[model samples]
Target chain A: MQKSYLMAPGPTPVPEQVALRMAAPAIHHRTPQFSRLFRETHEGLKYLLQTENDVLMLASSGSGAMEGAVVNAMSSSEKAIVINGGKFGERWGKICEAYGLEVLWLNYPWGAPADPAQVEELLLQHENVGAVFVQACDTASTVAHPVACLGKLVQKHPRTLLVVDGITAVGAADIAMDRDGIDMLLVGSQKALMLPPGLACVGVSTKAWEKISQSDMPRFYFDFQKERKALAKDTTAYTPAASLITGLHEVLAMIRQEGLAHLHKRTELLARAARAGLQALGLELLAPAAPAASCSGARLPESLDGKALVRYLRDTMGVTVAGGQDHLEGKIIRINHMGYVDSFDIVTALAALEMALHRFGQPVKLGQGVAAAQEILLERYPS
Target chain B: MQKSYLMAPGPTPVPEQVALRMAAPAIHHRTPQFSRLFRETHEGLKYLLQTENDVLMLASSGSGAMEGAVVNAMSSSEKAIVINGGKFGERWGKICEAYGLEVLWLNYPWGAPADPAQVEELLLQHENVGAVFVQACDTASTVAHPVACLGKLVQKHPRTLLVVDGITAVGAADIAMDRDGIDMLLVGSQKALMLPPGLACVGVSTKAWEKISQSDMPRFYFDFQKERKALAKDTTAYTPAASLITGLHEVLAMIRQEGLAHLHKRTELLARAARAGLQALGLELLAPAAPAASCSGARLPESLDGKALVRYLRDTMGVTVAGGQDHLEGKIIRINHMGYVDSFDIVTALAALEMALHRFGQPVKLGQGVAAAQEILLERYPS
Candidate 1:
């Protein structure tokens, strides 16, 4: 019998309870039953985001929310500074350009975080800079950008809102939206929320809302002001992904039960264990300086094909992980450490990696990586 | 114990098997297994749409696809003739205006279908008319517009594309996109597809694609060209609503087994029975001249509160239907006839309505509407 394990960064394994909750009979969106659920879920989102702002739930993927952030917070006449560090960061620039906004791109190498000082310099140089877009953590490179630092920098410019795509970082990392001065924080349900890949929630600060009201951009479905007004009535402007929102209600309950601090601690520990396990195998980290707690990326040896290794793990071993994109393709492999993942899942991943490497004619000890991961993971339990 | 029955126009009850299929473990979107499922579902959509044109599945509600249709098919400099008959028809003009397109609105009274001669005259008068937007069936008024007739008129203008919001009509009505010369046809999953909200599919003809290529409208999440390119790869441009698409695969399979023509006939038969039954209850049909087969709307007696009657039917009798929106808020009630509905469901709706009306102090004879409906519904199983 073959059992599958999903270890991808986003679209992480959904908890059985959450899946069952979503599987239950669908409810009408306009009813008091759904409105109550929505209100509770909205409160939970505020708790998770550590914000007092209104969070709008959208029936779309993270990219749609990212686009909403662009069109709502900035007008076409204003310029946007996009920190292009990875695939998702590049997306910010593309979305800005698509909306006819002039984009000032700050290009960083893949796996490297953007410098806040450089962004500050650009903000000083440009007059009508409306917003700065960056990822809290880019899933492509598994690199966490300096969100709080960037937020502090952008907060100095009243007109420039700090838009952070916290798709992989919101639940996994400790990001207080208000404290961090994040004007707009985007979260995808499939990521740290431990759900499927349809629903996206954006926590919009009062600062962002002011900019949104003045923006004359072309938008209908992703209209933030309309969503905000609907949220006040405990509903969405459009028909929400009811099943996903139902699932979100369950997931948020679990998060509330566990408490945000404990959840963030657990995620960090898992990521640390994963990195230690990979390091024990003599692998170099992709983003050693600014690794995200959501997932970990490591470079494979030149002799080994990372693509085939990932394929072997997924197709043969029934363990799904992610291979690198673009220039890093066939050179790196990424393993997730957040969401419903626990200590053993990390060990299983390390164990599978060791076996897969050994199978590929590499001289590797089977339990070497597992032993290293367990040493750090044991901290979760008693001494 | 109360067993609730959903008879709303949209968010139609999902079939048990389809819900269970979607409830199964979430699958990673970027995989061969998902690709195969996507390809199969795409083929089924083509069959349902009755078109060889590329149908792009988007991760948003039907309104989002409505916006995509406006931005992609027409440029800001071009004038659009919007057939504003009801709430949804008026939405076509609003979306056009939101994107900066000059909208020439042909305003018809709610529940009244637009005249093709008027649209033809407008097309002839406006030199740079890029498109004509109308609904195949406007859900709010339950009116079916003359799509085929409008198509014939719009076909004469090489520069003008005909976009139809077939949210409640595609599967319920006999809308053959290619034969009708429709440039763009939009479908929502919740209406006749027996799925939840958050998934919308747009069938784009070659004529629409030609206009789309020349249009330089601002769009990112609802970009038709990007979606078309991804559909060629058997996937969507963005992360698809995977769970909803999974449900859609099962639903389309059911549709295929039932056959499109049979499905349409069944819907029309149900709508006919519903209208006849409501008329028997001494009620007036909302759209007597051109009622959509997807759902039936009826005007209530001025003495009775339509909203309270609807609430009693839903809360007390455990039968859920729709109340009117906007000006008709307390003046009308709507009952759905499409999506997983049979003759008996129609009878249940009518019986509940009769009981609710009786409770609300209106003279409603129990089974009078049922007997009238059964006379027509009996055609489904005649010897």
Candidate 2:
């Protein structure tokens, strides 16, 4: 109805430039123009995935890549360990179990980081474990995992690959797949990359690729070997979702231009500003108290109607934020500071939150949250 | 350097209007705006597919939908009849075999359509042929199969389902799914609909959905059950490719505005023009003996190299035509008259073919092909 802001964890507001590029004339995949774009995106995806592993582009959502990571890299009858603290974390176990794999999942309380110790214990205990799956950031938890710590365990068990769903963490979080020793790092264009969600970018290590060679899994579309063969020519094995790839080419170019380090820092600053604003508003964060952070979250104040507040913000103000899921539903609200976020956006979100709370009969000091958010913004990036 | 033209069968050039819609803005999948767009596209896809079956959307290529049809509708152990007449047709057998299914293929030469009688014979002979899979128009052969006729046989069997890949034929061909008794028909946005690829739409009948209820083939990403469940809410089980979905919505509006009959007629007229132009150019069609009758398949002249000629048109004159695959490679060239085709486009393709042939030292009369194409266009439309 209006110029909307997607303050969700993913499918975040896309850049105008990326959208324009997607609208660019489609090039035949077999042609040199497409070949060049495909090669660059493939290379850029690997770099974004931060791995020396061969990167594969999939014309699917982030979950498709997650399913692809397990099915192609491990036999269906094999066992795998997954961390289930939130929706996406549970997704790994669900995908593995659907394939008849024996899954050892360490389920943590929602809104808490997946305990690495428990994951390590599960990995050591599960004799049939062929892979260890974890999401670097669980949007449902509003918490980021210690992937560098988990990567160490997977490095020891070379046969058991550590797969990370970096949907919410790829560009926003500091992930160096090579340095962190991640076997399969999965990402999509929609999240922190500031593009749409039609493309899933997966980095597959040599170890993961070798597992695929022996896998008898019945996969045709997500078959890593077939995709690898096509990737060699900088083309997809099957017809790809072309416009999304075109959009990604633009988004990747922009990312390269902005520099990964700079984007990460910008994202972190936005997250911090949001967190500071919520604290100043006398709200508790839904996430477990820890140094590890992701999207800023705040528990709904007792006097504020969470649903009504969020609805009012969306309808009256033009700010769209995500409400809590599962157990945390109706108890907290999440304001995503990922994808193309800057200090101004952080201040705007807080200002909208203040207005919505007031409209919902939870009257607060005028400009309380915005003032604090602006204070953090000035501290981090002074005007 | 110039605006590209995608002439591939699938992933054809996307409409500029649709691209503009995609670039408009992002919205959350669960939001009302996205749900509205998703619902519109779903309903529009059903109309285009001409099936009462629920049309499900997947964030993958056409191949993913092909995989979904095979894996979700039938188990790995069942006997299935596969038709392998071209590259895409071969995929039916390959995916089935990969899944350990006992396949009885009615193999025909790649360039020709498999006879429906042969399919009937195979079904009669096989003890337990659970399903049938085929491409309505195999892009590799540029030939249209008698899907309606094949559906008749499978319809009589009742136990056997007629699954057709309408990926290349959906928006262009006249294979009405419900009218033809097609149980499952799959298509992507790239082909006849003139949208960039990224979303694969599958129309599954109640029978197919019933099989899906009990299917044991392991699946998570391309899970039809999950998608079907989410369809009830007019949203996806997971985050959808919003921008691509947005683009698809706009494309559907265009298709609806043009009406299916009008679009199909336009395609037919252009196809006839291309065929006439190729004939006037004195080129032999590889499949002329039993031509597909839709896409013109011209055999390379004796002195002209097909691959080099294709490159010459693309590089020198900015025309992108498809070269053949596998056995057909470098032996023939394909001119598509599917999406967004007009008499002028036919003229451009004819001119490019003539120039490429001249460069390759083929004997050709100046402007002969273009003139013939124009004459055919005038005669057909009386303008």
**Model 1: CA > 4 A from native:** A1-383
DockQ, computed on Cα atoms, for candidate 1: 0.01
Compute each candidate's TM-score over C-alphas: 0.52, 0.51
All models: lDDT? 0.89, 0.76
Best by lDDT: 1
- DockQ of predictions, in order shown: 0.01, 0.01
Q: What does the lDDT read for residue A119 in candidate 2?
A: 73
